[model samples]
Target: MPRRLVKVFARLNPRRSPEDSLALRASVLASILTAELTILAMGYYGLITTVAVPLLTAAGFYISWRRRRERNLLIKLILAVMVVAAAVIFLRELAGSLYDTRLPLIRLFLWLQVMHSFDLPARRDLKFSLVSGLILITAGAVLSISMTYIAGLALFSAAAVAALIQFQLSEDSQRVDRVVAADPWRLAAGSFLVWLMLVSVAVPVMLVMPQSTQARLTSLPVSELTKIFSDFPSEVVNPYYREGGDPFDRPPQFSADSYYGFNPYMDLRSRGRLSDDIVLKVRSDRYDFYRGIVFDVYNGKGWEMSDEEGEDIVSSSPPFELPVDTSMPRGGTSIQSFYIQADLPNIIFSGWRPVSLFFPADRIKIDKYGSLRSPYQLTDDTVYSVVTEQPLTAGSYLRRFPRAGDPAAGPEYTALPDAYGADILEIEKLTRGLTGSYDNTYDKVLAVERYLKETYPYDLEIGPQRSERDAVAYFLFEEQAGYCEHFASAMAVMLRSVGIPARVVTGYTGGSLNPFTGLWEVRQSDAHAWVEVYFGSAGWVGFDPTPGFDMPGDASRDRDNFMLSGIIDYLGGIDFGPAGRAVSAAGAWLGRGAAWLTSVPLAQLSAVATGAAALAASAGLALRRLMLRRRQSRLATAGLSRELLRDPSLKGYLRLLKRLAGIGLARRPEETLRRFARRVSLSTGSADFEELNAIIEELRYSGRPRSDGDQRRVAALSLEIDERLREGRAATGRA
Candidate 1:
């Protein structure tokens, strides 16, 4: 048999290896493609950056294949220099990412991966490329909050399994100068089966792991302030929605692309189903509202900010103090940074009582209401930071003050249009009814907020409010069910009529915190409005009357399955009509169940136990089959020593070696018997394996057949090694 195998090997010379198989090359490309795709999903790439990266990667692979005829040191040196330059650029850009530096580092490696693609001349280099795909995918998984990552991960895993399988075959084929026992389709099916098994194990394991509720964040950021262009009248420009006439007009209104409340004059009629597209990502020290455009004037129809002469804040740079109210008491300091993910209004959003700015624009217009507006409209990738001294807003502090009969918030806030008519009286009567029992302004605000939340359910499906009636009146008396806009508008107008200085504030409610990124993902659906009531010396305090919504200051402990919700949103957005909605609804149910399973300790523990047992059983069956096949092959074949497979001592030693390999002590093809014995000795923490190797070596070299006593001695050593190996593996927690 040995002579026949030698003759076969001689027919195909191992010295001059053949070109890489198409399967091997394609597998390598698939792995590279996965890494590139992961980098693109991170949302930082520009149009050119997005298009150029994958093109460069594909081009690099093509170059490597064509240039495989010869190796070039110069080419490698140049690519190395390019990678180094990319790293230098990344480091410079990293100045802005210090608050969360993981992403920029990952992005740097992505660029390195692209540059290194041109030099995968050897199988080892291709394998390295395959492994780097894992690194990139893992990094993307860590930073990405979207459920779309799950799909990308699936793609990478399948490709990686196939790549590893092809690599194994290629390595073996290279050793013999020809493919051995090759069945491409069978191997392909095996890879798929392996992937399926892996996915099955991973899903249950993940389902069993407890989810963390760590949304509250305190982080920092990147950017330098640019000199302002002479404080341009920062107009509200909704890039996706502004395909029309004045936002303030009646005829051309209600855009699905934009939140109506973001305009100069919010028309309550324009409230529709806002898209679930993520708009902003915020990293802040504490949970708080991203306060934006504040409106004091209620025109019966909607609300608008008063045309007070605003001050243009022209500064050389950022971190400058804002003109804040000296009368308002300062509490804990909170720092926040914003990453604009979508084109938005020119308003600068910050936590309550913004003390300083890190805005990029040279100048910002500060309205009397303390809201800041930038000269430039915010576009995607716009970055800024803010330092805020949160108002002494604890309930205990606010409860100490009484409701001022005449608030010091000035007449603009309390001024209601006479056009509101008797409808205004009805609002006053309702507000007084809700807050009549409360002695202090804080309690009064809470009472009105609670009443609205309980009585008027927040429903986004409601149509535009009637143009004939006051928006607030219609919301309170007729519909009694509306979203944040109607609730906020009603609350603001109601408070004003009842002699409390209140204004409607619009911006995004800080969305769910991404546990991985530590950033609040603010979606378009998260766009919200709430009322801020004045309490003489207490300053402006925020209140939300929308159902299922709380004040911005409150930290959210109940983090829903946001990842699953993202999946639902993604599915819902696909233009599949009613079927898409059904899919979305199904996803919602799954998300809820997942959230429950993760939250409940008993459920998680049970799942872990079940999954672990199933995996263990499967592994045991596979290992048993593998060992049985190897044992049968060895028994049938003549090999190893002078006595061949018939010799008892040699057979015993071979069996012992196979046992060691079964428990993950497999010897490499290049390892000598003595070297392999040494490694097994370390792995199993037993010298018995070495003793068995020595006996077999001595007997084989001495040209003598093994005696019965020698066979018994070998068996004894094997038993001792098995016992010790188990002890060693268990000690290391790998058993």
Candidate 2:
């Protein structure tokens, strides 16, 4: 039909035009290459090399030749079969995606694009294919926040510009009166310029846009996606195993033995390595140990809860008031919010002596030793709050006051197994000199703490104790080296031998603070053990005997302030007054709303919130529409032509182009006016055409200041070109 179509079709004709075919193949190759980079960015390299590359290559080869040929039934049938297979896979994945719906949806979208890649026969189809590549790149952006995605985006942008420019130029090559086709080098340079312009605009917009604080959608289910892709054993994927029973039957115990620090039982002899995996993110005004579980009984080898089944507190709703008495005269209060990152047991970790726990659970349990446990297992989705009252043990008033032991808490706090009597004797002998060194109980506990810190070395990889000796005895008498657990156990046992009611408590130490989130990232390595001694009036006072460990009061305060300084520095240049005001107003409104809603039932509260959100959305939509309509009306009456003519240089250039067209000397579609004017001047023997061309080029391309004198010169040149063109036309007609 057209010359362009003939050229495109000739590529498929083996004997007709091998060069055209090769060039078309190169363009298709560039498009496919960039598409593969995008696919790799989405972490689908296996699929790219295995399916996409070969399929796209074959499709491109077939389509380049088939532009003007009749549709082949065999190819149509093959494409139909592929569509059917992809549909079946999509349905299967959709049905199986019970754990995460997004994974299956993304996979199905990818499959559809892959199937469509083979059927790209027309120029429109090729454009659609490139658009599909863009869609996949967007999916990759949604799936990853890594720097690799940025690199992929950059590469894809460059390749896409090149392919689109080449495609447009090739299509236009068939049109009548079109100028010389763009060379490959010119096309590549234009693509580079386009990419640079896009990046220049995009970066500023990205910097100014509000950053989201929500967890990334892609990172949320990455582990689950990895499981689907990896070649791991079935047992590793599905951890439930049946023993001599129906395979469908549930296992006897939910094995959490893999998480070393969180297990209910702790064997001191077995020194297992800890992972750096983050387990908890906490936001609180003060820093303190995130107490998980406490073990009152210490057998010779390990620590265990004396009673595995704790007493459950009966409650109809949440905000469970723990049995801990926070009304003590010397108690200091703090509020904490926790977000769990990893799957953990149904234990609620908070600062020492939690007074009130607010969660979505129906019932909660507390052991006799002040350890809080949840009614259900907690995973990454679990978020809860705790209101804790830490005793003001650091204060001068509490340290000076000599409080008697609580007889009610006597047996549980001071209880030690009879089998460890040798350990008790050794503890007493070792602490004999320090027993009478302090008159007050606080001073006595401090002395014991000082002794452990000064005498012992902290070693995570301590050797196993002898069969005859208890772990405490070995750590205190012979080894003189161990981790937090050993130091805490030794101090507690030594205090108990001297009639002080002390017990070892297990929990996480203060974690590293994240400046961006204002949350403490508590890793598995932060797991620690410390001693809590019972004081009659002041309640249980926490004391860490670990060598490098600092008390939560001073250490946490300093660290929190340091992290806050970093946050301030990060936001140094940004104006936050409006944002701060908005946040404060939102907080105040939420506080008031919560206070009012607390009296209402939870079901009603949820309904009210949903209704309120819908109403607000509707109002916002109506307001936006009204504003848009008003803006359009204003623009319609504003005289856009008059506004454009306000610039004298642009006005003069337009007038000159219009005057030239009136004389039947109009510029060609692909020709620059400067070149057109030079040709015209040679034919007409007029210098005015060249002069006018120079003035127009300067005003358009040079980006220089145009004065009144330049404007007057442009008007004079335009008149002279018009007169010369008229005279030349008359002379030609007369000849």
The segments of candidate 2 whose C-alpha lies over 4 angstroms from its true place after superposition are 1-265, 314-317, 324-326, 330-332, 404-408, 417-422, 556-735
Kindly report which residue pairs in candidate 1 clash with one another: 96-222, 218-285, 227-362, 228-362
lDDT of 2 by residue, 1-735 (tens): 677765664454333221133354456555555655555544433554446654655564556445424344445557667778877876796664433355566665665655565555556656676777787677666444234666777887877777777676666454322233457687678679878866865553333233222222211131212111222111111122123332212222323233333555566665655667778877666667888777677776667666656676655444578885544664567777677777766677889878777665555677766777765566774667777886676657657544444334657667666787877787788776787867777778888999999989999776556555777888887888998888988888888777778877777886765544545678767778888887667667789999989777764244212222333333342336877656665655655553444445646755665676577668768976887555433322222244334665555445545444444344554466667767556656666768877876676567677878888887777666555555655221111
Best model number under TM-score: 1
Cα-based lDDT for every prediction: 0.72, 0.61
The candidate that wins on lDDT is: 1
Q: Candidate 1, which ten residues in sequence have the lowest lDDT sum? A: 10-19
Whole-model lDDT, model 2: 0.61
Q: Alpha carbon lDDT of residue 607, candidate 1?
A: 65
lDDT measured at residue 193 in model 1 versus the true structure, 0 to 100: 89
